[model samples]
Target: MNIIEVEDLTTTYNGHTAIKNISFKIEKGEYVCLIGENGSGKSTLIKTIVGINKKDSGKIIKNIPPEKISYLAQNNMIDLNFPATGKEIIMTGVQKHKCLPFYKKEDYKKFADVCKLLNIEDIINKQISDLSGGQRQRIMLARALIRKPDLLILDEPCSGLDVNITKELYNILNKLNKEDGLTIIMATHDLEEIKTIGVRVICLATTVKFDGDIKDWKGEM
Candidate 1:
């Protein structure tokens, strides 16, 4: 099944074209890596797919509803000084579907399951500011997963992390995609980092430069 289909998509920011005439289709349960140089429209394309930015032209057909898709943007935008606990942050994912401010027993249980899967159960009570970069990323991922989304979109998820930590994060995402059957589309410039988990590669340079299996992507890096 095609989870997302973008046909000749174009997007602009303040009248400046970001991505132009890009087209692609994301299949169900596929792990796709969006790669390109800086300001090459990788972020712009995914943002358009996720509906974060409006497309200036073309059509986007999403098999899943907007609410069923979970997104993790480029950077952690939450205030580090915020006193919210890990659990509190994760529970916020359920707020969109809730009529009350408080979580029910099942909501708490789902949060616990997601925490255990992410291996952050020990820090559930800890403040977000107290965790390491990796731990904090995991918390954010857990929060994204609390929605049980069919499609997971992440933008430059490993922007400022060491190689080892970045690989660990990919392993977690691999498990989620391979084991749990979640379709994932992540944008990153580091091709080496995705060598282990990348099933498909979509290289964009303000357009569709290449779109094929990872092994067939022959562009010079």
Candidate 2:
């Protein structure tokens, strides 16, 4: 089933055009990668789809409800020294759901299960600042999954991680996509590296350039 559909989408910032006349559809259980240079509208497109940025003129139809989508913005933009526990952060994802003034026992169990799935139980009690880079990433991912979202969207997820940590993150995301049938849409600059992981590649540069299988992608910005 198609989870998202965009038609002639356009986005702008400060009256400057960012994305121009782009269109695409994302199906359930698809692993899609948006690749481009620094100012290539990749972020704009994602922000538009996620409603962080409003479209100037276009149509964006989401088959699933807004609450069914979970987004992980760039880590660099997030304050890591918030003095919150990993478990605390994960529980925040459930705030959108119907719950009492405090989390119920079932809520705690769900969060614990998500942490276990991400192999982050060890760091659940640690301060967010005390965790290592990879561990922190896993914790963030656990938070995203705690809500049991149908679609997961990440922006520049591998920006500052080491090679080993990046590989581990890829493995975890692959498991989520293949084993659990989760839909993933990630924006990254490392196209050549993510080609093997993504089923479809969307290259953007102020407009949609390529939208097809990774094997058929031609080299260009």
Candidate 3:
């Protein structure tokens, strides 16, 4: 099943074309990576996909509900002093309109499961500002997964993590994808990490430069 379809998509900023006439389709349960050099419109394309920016032309067809599409931004924008605990931050993934005096039992169970899976249960009560960069990223990921999103859109998920921590995070993501069949769409510059995940490759150089099996992508680094 095609979860997302983009045809003839175009976006421009200040009279400068960011992405020109790009097109692609993402199938259900498929892990795909978007790769390109700096200024290649990768971020612009992601913003357009998630409706943060309006497309200049063409259409996008998303089979999943808009709320089911969870985007884990590269850098979280929440204020460190917001006074929300790690668990509280994760609970926000539940629908905002749903009125509830407290998180339901099921919600707590899911949150616990995610924290365990991410190996962050020990820090559930800690403040977000007190955690390391890697821990913060993992918490954000747990928050993303708490919603049980069908499609996970991440931008530079391992951007600043150390080598071992990066490997650990991807290991968790790999387990999630394999065990739950989650569909993942990530924009990353980590070519080595991409090879480790072994997913389909989508290269964007101001447009759709390549899209096919990962084994077929022989572009130079």
Candidate 4:
């Protein structure tokens, strides 16, 4: 089933239209990539869909509830210097659920499972300020995963990582999509990254320039 549908969507930033007349659909359990040149609204489109940016026109249909959607914003948007341990940072994701003052046993289990999946159990106790670049990225990803989301959305997830770290992050995402059946939508500027792992490519330039199998994409963006 289509878990997300965008029909003629238009959105703006600072009173300027960033995306116009955009449309697309994402099936459940699909791994979709959004690719585009700089200033082409790739980030705008993703943010609009997730409500970080508001749409001025058109429709965004989500088959799943809002709480089931988890978004990982850009690395610059995160402040690793925040005075919190990785575990403390991650458990905040659980706060959006029931608004309780305390976490349940299941919440702690979710944390453990996500850490294991990301191979980040060793760093969960460290202060975010002390983690390496790769470790920080994994911790943030763990934060997203601990939410137990059905759909994970990310914006340029590999922005500041080194080559090996990028590959490791890709491997983790592949496992999540293939082995765990989580739906994913990621915005990126790398073409090889799209071809190597993404199943579907949605190329955007204000609107969708192409939307199809990743193999069918011809390095358009």
Span of ten consecutive residues with least summed lDDT in model 4: 189-198
Candidate achieving the largest TM-score? 4
User: Model 2 scores what on Cα lDDT?
Assistant: 0.86
Off by over 4 Å in 4: none
Each prediction's TM-score versus the true structure = 0.94, 0.94, 0.93, 0.95
Q: lDDT ranking from best to worst?
A: 4, 2, 1, 3
lDDT, model 1, position 171: 88
lDDT of 1 by residue, 51-163 (tens): 77999999999998877899887546668789999888898887776777787898888898898888898998999899987788888888899989999999998888677
| Whole-model lDDT per candidate | 0.86, 0.86, 0.85, 0.86
Instruction: Name the weakest run of 10 consecutive residues (lDDT summed) in model 2.
Output: 190-199
Residue range 1-221, candidate 2, lDDT tens digits = 99999999989977799999999999999999998888999888889889899999999999998778998877666688889988878888888966666988988888878987878878899998998777888888888888888999999887888888888888888889999999999998766567767578998889888889988998776
Report the C-alpha lDDT of model 4 over 1-221, residue by residue, as the tens digit. 99999999998888788899998888999999888898889899989989888889999999998888898877667776788999988898887857666889999999889888888888889998899888888888888888889999999988878889888988888888999899999998767765787588888887788889988878555
- Model 4 earns a TM-score of 0.95
RMSD to the hidden true structure, all candidates = 1.4, 1.5, 1.6, 1.3
